[model samples]
Target: MTGEAEQQLRAYVEYFRDLGVREFYRRGEPVFAVETVAPAVAVASALFAAPEPVAERPIVARKPDFLEPPIANPVSFDQLAPLPKSRVPASEKAAALLAVQQEIGDCTRCPLAYAGRRKIVFGDGNPNARLMFVGEGPGADEDTQGLPFVGKAGQLLNNMIAAMGLKREEVYIANIVKCRPPNNRVPEPAEAGVCTQFLLQQMDIVQPEVVVALGATAALYLLGVKRSLSSLRGHWHTCRGAKLAVTYHPAFLLRDPRQKGEAWKDLQMVMAEMGLKAPAKG
Candidate 1:
């Protein structure tokens, strides 16, 4: 085969590998004129290029179920349940939130409950907050403190709220999942599926006027569609009766500080909609 053809075959193999499509099966004997090429590359080449019929019988092998990526049809928050017939009265929002927390007492509803979780981080911040921030999940600091966003990411989130001319106490902060996943990894769909039911209830009670999804994972579960974050940003979406916006997670901004400006842009959009003004430099 030509060098260009060989290079094309390698790219296909890498692309599939990145998608977790490992263990490709050979359909027929190698069709390439060169016998020196490896068997795996030969199979890839045939799949990529038009095939000339060969004498060997076709072989089909099913990829193992264990190797498959986790699949879930996440239900959007709006469709999870009908909104309450009447909004919880603001005078009793705090007690209603506390009742939801008590309902989750010593919970073992999901695998994350047993995944070395030190505490179930229910939520924190104003019960009557007009703004809410939803993050992916807890980390070591959050798990230890049993409150959302108390770590470095939390510190950065506090700054993000401050930038919006609001104190952290003025906004409700929670996560897609209350418990920290093992090693701060993204929560599995099954895990998030179970936990977000509570989050939905929390949002219903707090009734924030605007909700900010702090990362792709939070956006995925909140919006129930897996689109790029950029597409979801700079637009208005509704969730549980509030306008929604997507932005970079503080953890991500910490890793790539340059994007902090972009995150600020997202927050500024929220601020403008809410008629908020940042504090003057003094």
Candidate 2:
């Protein structure tokens, strides 16, 4: 086969594999084992030959080598856990968040733990802030520094925060998964499932008044609904007792700069709700 054919074959195989067909076995016994169908006589003979008396045996279907794993549905942050009887006090929110981080120490609760992560990148910024930003997961720079959004995307995010007339330090930043997914692929649903348990706890403690989901994945898990970012954008959603807004991830805006204006519009909606105004241009 040529290279293109091989690629096409691989694509088909993966497509079938995704659909739960691992190996293709013969579907069923052939109509004729040794005889070729010869015209009308063969057809009539075969139709009449079904009268042969034979002992009946039970038909057993061969099972596949492995079953396709179940797809994990995204559960909204609120549905993940019940609200605490009482909210974490602002005076102790920082220490309470620290305790949550310590509990996640050297965390191996999810597969991302062993996916060559250098640090846990628990979260960053003010624990008691009324605004929070949630991204999908860490990148190379974040994994190295044990912080979220510290790379080029982070720079754009800082600019975005500045646009909102707020300092990055004034808001809490975190992700659905704490560790860098290998090669920065979207976190598997199972991985996000394991980590968001911790994330929900962080939200509960921080009790931010507003949350900005910085992409589809963040919006999906935060809102527990698989929706187009366009559908989720330009509207208010609720998460962890805070209003939520969805926008393109900074990384995506980096790839497609034209969308920055739309993202800014999303931010402006957030600013209006939070009583924030853009900084005066210098």
**lDDT of all predictions:** 0.83, 0.82
Q: TM-scores for all candidates?
A: 0.75, 0.75
lDDT of 2 by residue, 1-282 (tens): 966455445543443333332121123333334332235665445445444334543222333222335345767888878888898889999999999999888875555664567999999999889899999999999999999999999999999999999999999999999989777888777778778878999999999999999999999999989879999999999998899999999999999999999999999999999999998999
- lDDT per residue for candidate 1 within 1-282, as digits (tens), equals 866445444544443443332233345332444323346765566557554367744444444322345655778999889988899999999999999999999876655665567999999989899999999999999998899999999999999899889999899999999988766778777778778889999999999999999999999999899899999999999999999999999999999999999999999999999999999978
Provide backbone clash counts, one per model. 0, 0
Off-target runs (Cα >4 Å) in candidate 1 are: 1-71
Q: How close is candidate 2 to the true structure, as a TM-score?
A: 0.75
Residue 89 in model 2: lDDT: 83
> Which residues of candidate 2, in runs, are more than 4 Å off?
1-68
Candidate 2 lDDT score relative to the true structure? 0.82
